[model samples]
Target: MGADRGRRGGRPVRVGVYVGCGALLLAGCASMPDSGGLSGVESTPRQDAQVRVFAKSPSKDASPAEIVQGFLEALTSDDPQYETAREYLTSSASQAWDPYRSTTVLAEGPNAEAVHSGTSEGTAEILYRLSGSKVATVDTQHAYAPDSGSYSRTVHLTRQKTTKEWRIDGLPQGVVMGRTDFQRNYKSVNKYYFASNVSSETGGQLETVADPVYVRKQVDPMTQMVRALLKGPTRWLDRVVGSSFPTGTELKKGVKSLSPDDRNMVTVPLNQKADHVGQGQCSKMAAQLLFTFKDLTPTGVDEVELQKSDGSQLCVLTEDQADGIASHGTAHYPDYQYFIDGKQRLVRMPSSGSDKQPEPVPGALGDGDKKLRAAAVSRDESSAAGVSTDGTSLYVGSLVSGGSLGEAVLHSQGKTADDRLTTPSWDGQGDLWVADRDPKNPRLLLLQKGAGSPLVVETPSLDGRIKAVRVAADGVRIALIVEKDGKSSLQIGRIERGTKSGEPPTVSILELRSVAPQLEEVTAMSWAGDSRLVVIGREQGGVQQMRYVQVDGSTPVGTAPSALTGVKEIAASEDERLPLVAHSQEDGIVRLSSGEQWQKVVKDGTAPVYPG
Candidate 1:
């Protein structure tokens, strides 16, 4: 029998009967002999399992409007090939369409309607009204850039006589996904780039900075991200950074794809032209790839192998080896808190555990009766800029003991002290920035370290006044708090270096972008991290609070830690790990508590500051 077949069986038995003594009567008795009944069994058959799969395809009788909607909706799916989405388009359209060209992120579902434009019944048009802000756009080069505003698009459709169904005969080149779908289908990743030069303050270490960009999570993100890195930094960052990839360089033709093998090793084939490059340069290029793809799912690529077009290995780098070739600088903060002490003298609060009392900094500004109101220390901690108590003169001098206090570098233009200069801020380049809020000649000023005169930085015409100005570590961006019509706003402006060279290097404000639009009144703000700011503001008719917001005017998700009440002035380092220090109305100067609450760190201190 076959292995699947069951066995058939039967049972047998014996019987006893009476003798045939009586021949005639025994004939009936012999028939009465006992007998056992017969028994048997049969085999049963097995059934095979059935399975079903669903294919998302265009409907045979879909209308022109439906075809357009279906194509847009299909974009949110995990089908990276977008085969089903192609079903809604004609063969020619399908072949010409390039979904990777760009992505228009809409606020919500698009409103699409069919419009009979021409006399022919085979042709139709669908007008899509895309409401809400266009938060961002990903270009063909895969550079994600922030854009703001609203817009509309029109998608043309056609019908086929044989199928009697509508298809997208003409449409936009790129895909459009709703915000919800965008969040699900795309991920934000940072590509590393080196600063143009080594930091003057830190001996000679390469400064690696992260440039955040978005990529399709399900697509061949490794390839896409590498291509973007090879394209160099975005336009905004071009002037401030450098890349390892040589100019006019790109991956070899016919070698467009990249993927990790079973061992999590990714091989990148470049053009034969790159074969002439040296090993050190090749290692830098490989390091860029390793860092860019470090956060990918299913285990990141552990090692990267770079190859020439001929398939010869140019260089191979493991993650550990890459780390040794590139590194980022640590956050630079002053060792002590510099502020005005109770005696109206420039003093330093011990940041470490060794000191028991506040000590005055060395300098005539700290020893003499100069009566300083505000002070700022340079990133190198070698020099200091101080404002007078009367707010009439701004002085600059050495922080060392017995150092001469220079003549006033800036003077108040206003008659009253209220319109004088606010706190001064120092940029990484050693230039000092301050805003002269003097109503008479209100403007921003930039002073070169040893320059005799200060360069005037133009400010945008506003109904309100410029209260505070803070320069970022990059030295190319500035944050301003403007008060207009009894309301305050947090604004970020790019510092445009003047083309005409002068003693102080002429500078001006090109434009300003709002950061915290929802805040009714902004009290204070400091650069907490790269591309992020810690702001203390109050909502319209609400209490005062502090929160973290992106420099692009987007609020970060999740509620912020407990708000610091009665905060008069706040200061923070570029490092987010550093605790926030603030001068409160009730407790003087304080830092964040272990539980993220505000606790007093010092008494009788004001206008605390840290290096930018």
Candidate 2:
């Protein structure tokens, strides 16, 4: 929710036409073979992922600059082994350099400038500075993290006595490439895990959380993804998500590849670390695999079979069985998109593209005299939470009719509406979360099952008061609009819950980092995918914009939501198939159906929201 000002702040690759072969400066294009219903790490027409990069060996008599440039270019290629990139390096450097150590993505192609030139023991010694603005980095685990700053590295080259050719003698570990090239060579994939801190007594909804990472697009992505999953979640998410695989569990030694069998099941052979696990834990591990692969190998993958170190069956889990172990939200379809209407009544419309008159939900929020300023429906649509018009009270009630509205479950002491409570949000585990904007005692509160005493969530790292809050359906991550110094930014934080000895479990919103640092102020945001958020904000003093940002703070490669004006509140379903619902000042309660413009749903409606 924000000022009326919106402000605020693909198709699979075609086979063939792969990288061209030959000894050119940069490697020619190449393509990967489509196998087992996979489509070469699918990309849209605009993305060059369909085109493979070929690394070119340094030309004869190449200068130090040329050798460094050739080697850097090779790092961006799809070559599985990066052999060509090694040719430009001295024999010892080649063996010591590890391209997979990490990837430092820069704002643009690096600039190489001669930093030093001299002679050491009659052999020509030279050094070039490769510099650019660092945007982010992907670690060896394929996890991504934002690391904004200047990036400067020295590439030392030497003239070999025998060949009299310049070759790189020393360079920083890991590959460096521009953002465009990084996206071309890598694709984001979600590694799944169980929510570590959610309440087991609260219906025990074992849910899977998304831990996104970048993997080489043209490599054996299925295998890479499986390996990443087995390695556990990214560092930031490691504390909040639990992996079923035991520590040190990994693919068996000498097992370098994995493929789906004729029955559409991918068999994974694990080392002894996973051999002693019982049926329950092993099945959970398989569930993690099936969840990660469902979207990856969409067409053929139906099961995940785990084999022990000696090739004996440990456990096998089919997609159907995994669904029983954890709720991934893939099967839950949102029933309706909801909002507060003209009379301040919580109202709803079918999620499908229907423009008929809206109806009030079957609850106190819908029919009671109490006026609500905003509301959040549960993902299952069985319950709803509403914030009073004055933003002082929060109420959670079932969607069923005839239920009486209980006293305010939460309240804020702020005297003004703007200083009171922002919109409240519901997570898949049936818990409700809201932030009180009280100037004297700002706090983020959580209520289990929407009742009982409100628990103050620990947010040790939060810099400013939270103006808005939305929890992902997975119950592991949260999107927050933080207001500070007259500007608001979108931050993605890890939601952690832990139970200490003889005490109730505690919850904390940890590591609140802005995902939309480019936006001067973020007006609204919603979880668009497992690790992506659709945010509405604008560059400092610029027109407001809407775009998708990875939880790791990287802009996604895709078309932004179509332009709209005066978006006060926005609602989106995890099911990308649903139309986007927004409360536009220009056209109240509008819907952006797939491939269609925003259509007015109701006049002057406010606070549109889909279930979390």
In order, the Cα lDDT scores of the candidates are 0.68, 0.80
**Candidate 1: 10-residue stretch with minimal lDDT:** 1-10
Residue by residue across 143-177, what tens digits does model 2's lDDT show?
88788899888888889999999898898898888
TM-scores for candidates 1 onward, in order: 0.73, 0.90
Provide backbone clash counts, one per model: 0, 14
lDDT of 1 by residue, 211-254 (tens): 65677665667777787888888665566577877786678887
The model with the greatest TM-score is 2
Clashing pairs in 1: none
lDDT of 2: 0.80
